[model samples]
Target: MHFEVPKVRMHSLREFAQHYFMIVLSILTALGLEQWIEHTHHRHAAEQASEQIEVELRGTLDSIHGALANNARQVAPLRTLKEAISDDVRRGLPDAQINQHIRELKNDFVLSVSWPSFATQSWDVAVANQSATWIDIDRLHKYATAYAAQRDASNWVTHDSTIALNGPRMVDLRTRINLGKDVDPVEFLGILQQMINTSTETSGHLEQTAKPIERALAEATN
Candidate 1:
């Protein structure tokens, strides 16, 4: 008896093609889903960061404005006391009263002057101590410069206003205090106040803008 060899069965061409098509479609779908998930996650993270920045910026602005107002108030009492003492001294008032007033004025002046410097120092510390990324640093620097310019201008106005108020009538006192023609204290103080206001505003804006950038950076990094 002769045995016939069995023929091997093969897959039809259509079935082979269908199998490969399904595999390709599955892989593409998986990749698409992964991309969508990643995009959504990044967007959420960015929004969170932006919100945080906005809140922080507002707080910073409030702190700065409060400092400025404090500085402005402090200057007034010290200035008035100084003027009184100086006027008494010029009019040949009793040595005891003059001396006492002078002492008190000196103390007040010292305290009043200390605040503006302190406010500036605080700002410096806050900005300088930040350990943000380079982009953040750059953004901060720009914000700071603009703020500083505004502060400087405001300070000038305040000084000028003060000087204008005290300069004309108190000739002997002005001379004693070395109040030059250019030294208008009121204007200077006004200018200083304006500077503070401007700086506060600018800082607010910067603080607001920073949030978005931070979010963007976070997303990019993620």
Candidate 2:
């Protein structure tokens, strides 16, 4: 069996062009609106991310301040330890009274010395999602610089902690006290001096690094 072809109507060139123009215009308009919506959503997300990051940085600053104060409190004890050790070396272990001093050093200084770490979740999220790019370049640069300083401070803290945790001095102190054995005062004094210097420098640098970050966060929030 043969099938008959159906009759079809064809458009004039002018009608076809007019239809084509409308279709293209509609597509372009839809694309423009979609792009605008996406842009607005991204900007809003970025602003939220900035605000959260600022709050987080403020918290980080507070942590740094607490750590600084804690470190500062160790200074006197460290000096006393140095002096006591020196006296022991020059003369002899002072007396039972010195045991009180030793206990104080252990309680106040050794146990108290610690490293501070901050949570950067907001910052990490913003950066990971590329929302940080929405912030002005200057402000972004400021944030980056502050974080860089924090990274340096963290490195110093890690170095100081390594010395504290792994040094022979800590072992010697523990052994001397627990066993009531005599430590080589001269060797102990040298180690104590190095620790004092490390703690002082690390605390100072951390404060300096954190202060600028705090100020920047304040400005950003404002």
Candidate 3:
């Protein structure tokens, strides 16, 4: 019941070296091709993300400019209304004229106007898919900062413009103006001044936010 041992074949030293060399070459080639494919895929993703971000940023910049312009236009009329109310109080203008002035002020207020939705679709997608991690760190930082500023400015703008809607402010305003109810000029002036101040602050913030976005765009192009 004894078992016979089988003889094993052995390679010559040169043959062994050649065989290992071929194995090493095959592994290296496979690794190289895999790395090249991965590099290509990452590069393509970055390029696509960049293009989408660039277009979205441009649209955002335009929206900021338009919003700023509209905000500025509201300022002059608000200032005029403030002055007119002051004069009417000081000079004792008729109640009818006062009501008319209130109407004018209301017309100028432009409440309920829509602000531009900051276009962040591409950025959001990049972030959600983790593709933004592939971007240059410095560029990504700048873009992120710009978007943050945009978000803040938008919040302020929306709050300031629509704050009057929170209570009976608009309702009271319309009723008072329509009915020619006697409103204290000083009180109304304060409200108008507050709105003007909010607009000024919002516009300034938006302008500052725009600079970073512009910088981001320049960096992207360069």
Candidate 4:
């Protein structure tokens, strides 16, 4: 690299001191400008990242709300079906009569519980690209808490629906009854009871998760 030295002659100690101070001041000013520019760039990047993440979170929250509503709709009808079946069994109705009644109410006898898998691609990319490091710590904590809640609720639902519950048996019973095949009323009632219980619990966890997400979004807006 080529280097150039300034052509200067100091006439006295005072002149030399002034020249040295000027050089130091110029260097400091240059450094300050560079730091300022870098800080501005980082702040802008952080803002953009935050905006993208928030938008994605809004979509995720919408998905969650939709799922909750759908499950709510499903739970009500499932409960009604269970109650009807219970009554039929209580009245000591014949297997043929109970079977025919269940087949007739096939629409209400159906059970469906759907839960959302929240979108986190934006947040994940921000974290991976180090943009999250620029976010304020308090805000970052809030975001983290919201995402944590989503993850926990998702895991719980997965376990309850797939592992803990007798999902296969329930589906099989539902299919047989819907297809106009004979199913023991008491046995079918038990499965319907399980479905009602599982859906209620899933909705509870989803509602619990929603609270943190709602709070985070509200605070972020303010």
Candidate 5:
């Protein structure tokens, strides 16, 4: 007797297809989740780096500001001395006495004040290196250099003028009645006063420009 063979079931084929589709869907979902996690981690790391940079910049700026403030304070006495010299010359004090006073003042400025001014400049250079913002770095460097150059130039000019008025030797010409006869006190005082005024104005401008940098640093830290 011949046995009848059973037909393949259509339902089984459909069930197998559904099982494979479910596996593919699950795999796709896992891949998507992994990619999202990696992206999030990378973003977090970048943000952390940015925050650390900002903190460092702020600390640098604060130190720079302290140095600037101290330097400004040191300059105050120099301003007073300059004004006094100008006033003395205007008052017709003997040229010899005025020259003597100016020489002493210059000595004191070089000995006592110059170091702190130089220190402030060093701080500025350091800050320029630490600066993250281009504007802050550029402006600070420019202004600091300008101010320092101006101060040095003024000092040189004053030194030369003093030498000219005092005559070729250390002898005070102002005290010599014959030499004083030819000296123009007004012109000498005018030159000194103009230098003082320029220095003062430059200082004010630097101070004003520094505030924005300070504020930006503060905000970055916060």
Candidate 6:
């Protein structure tokens, strides 16, 4: 900035003081404007990051609901065949009769279960770029809690399966069923119980994860 030169040379200290303060005021005003602009930018960035994360949470909620439904559907057929086999064995039916009952109850059964793929891509990106730091403290905390729960659920799905499920035995059962080979009814019954237990536990974990995400989304709307 160029300063205005006085038409007449300054003849008093008062004039010089007036000129100096004008220059200082001009510099302060410019600095204040820059600070305001920076604050606005950070605020906008935080808002955008929050919006993206909320959208992702909604998608995750949808997947969780879908998974719960899908798993229920898978369990239905399992329960049906499990009941049939259990009844036949309790009745002291011979292996041939049990195998025939099983064939009729589960003609094309496939052992399978659905596991939801939880996502935190938006949250991860926000953190990587430091945009999450710009968010309001309370809001940031909520978002962090939601994503952390999602991660926990995902990890639990993996860890629980390894710890609680009999992978090799389940594979053998599935193979036998597929080949129409005779299965020991009592042994097969135990495996079905395991499958049902795993499915229920998985649903429990997903439901827990869904709670924080649903709360976060609800708060965002408010």
Whose TM-score is greatest here? Answer: 4
Clashes of 5: 0
Error of 6 at 54 (Å): 1.1
Better of 1 and 6 by lDDT: 6
How many backbone clashes can be found in candidate 2? Answer: 0
**Native-referenced Cα lDDT, model 2:** 0.71
Question: Using Cα atoms with residue i matched to residue i, what is each candidate's TM-score against the true structure?
Answer: 0.43, 0.69, 0.78, 0.89, 0.50, 0.87
How big is the positional error of residue 58 in model 2, measured in Å on the Cα after superposition?
1.3
For residue 152, model 2's alpha carbon misses the true position, in angstroms, by 3.0
Model 2 spans with C-alpha error above 4 angstroms: 1-35, 84-111, 159-166
lDDT of 2 by residue, 97-214 (tens): 4554555455433534545677778888989999998887877887777777888777766665456443666667766766665445455566677778777777778878887797
RMSD of candidate 6 to the truth, in angstroms, is 2.7
| Local distance difference test, each candidate | 0.46, 0.71, 0.74, 0.82, 0.48, 0.83
- Please identify which of the two predictions, 1 or 6, would achieve the higher TM-score against the true structure: 6
lDDT per residue for candidate 6 within 1-222, as digits (tens), equals 455554657779998889778778888898899899999999999999999999999998999999999988888888888888888888899998998777676643445677777778899999998999999898898899999998787777667654676768978977887788988888888877887878877788888888988888888988
The digit string of per-residue lDDT tens for model 4 on 1-222 reads 222335699799998888788777777787899899989988998888889878887888888889899999889987888888788888999999999989988788666787877888988998999998998888788888989998888777656554545778878887897788999888888777777877888878888888888887887789
True-structure Cα RMSD, model 1? 13.1
* Alpha carbon deviation, residue 178, candidate 3 (Å): 2.2
Backbone clash numbers for all candidates listed? 34, 0, 0, 0, 0, 0
Ranking according to lDDT, highest score first: 6, 4, 3, 2, 5, 1
Ten residues in sequence with the least summed lDDT for candidate 1: 110-119
- lDDT by residue (tens digit), candidate 5, 193-217: 4444444444454455445545544
Arranged by TM-score, best first: 4, 6, 3, 2, 5, 1
Please give the lDDT score at residue 50 for candidate 2.
Answer: 78
